[model samples]
Target: MKLDDIKPDIVHDVTGTYCPVPIAETAKQIKEMEIGQILELIADDPGVVEDIPAWCSSTGQEFLGMYEEDGEYHLFVKKVKELT
Candidate 1:
């Protein structure tokens, strides 16, 4: 499915926040989500462009991809592994 076509189970808005905050919040929110569920992280931090995908890869999650909208980024991440 297209990245835009996928609806997120959770939408975490970290706009106006800086690096680490976006990634930090994403990490926390994903823990409360179920497997296969998608998390849509809305962040304005440029760091998220690299951080989100890297974080997903390292954490064994699916980095679905991202898109920019209204000067903000919409990062799509899917939960693949359960928190231990």
Candidate 2:
């Protein structure tokens, strides 16, 4: 299935937040989710456009894709690692 076709299990809006906040919140949220669960992170921080994907790569999560709407970014991420 396409990345956008996947339904998110959680939607996080970190619009006004910057830098580490978006990534930090995403990390916190994904930890509570089961493997294979999806998270839709909505943010306006330009750093997240690169940070989210890089964080996912480093953490072994799946960075499905992202889209922009009304100057906001929607990042699709999937939980691939189990929290130990």
Model 2, span 1-84: residue lDDT tens: 686588999999999999889988999999999999999999999899899999999899999999899999999999999644
Tell me the lDDT of candidate 1.
0.92
Model-by-model lDDT, in order? Answer: 0.92, 0.92
Evaluate residue 68 in candidate 2 and report its C-alpha lDDT on the 0 to 100 scale.
91
TM-scores of the candidates are 0.94, 0.94
Output the lDDT of residue 35, model 2. Answer: 96
lDDT of 1 by residue, 1-84 (tens): 798599999998999999779988999998999999999999998899999999998999999999998889999999999865
Question: Given candidate 2, what's the lDDT at residue 55?
Answer: 93
How does residue 34 of candidate 2 score in lDDT? 93
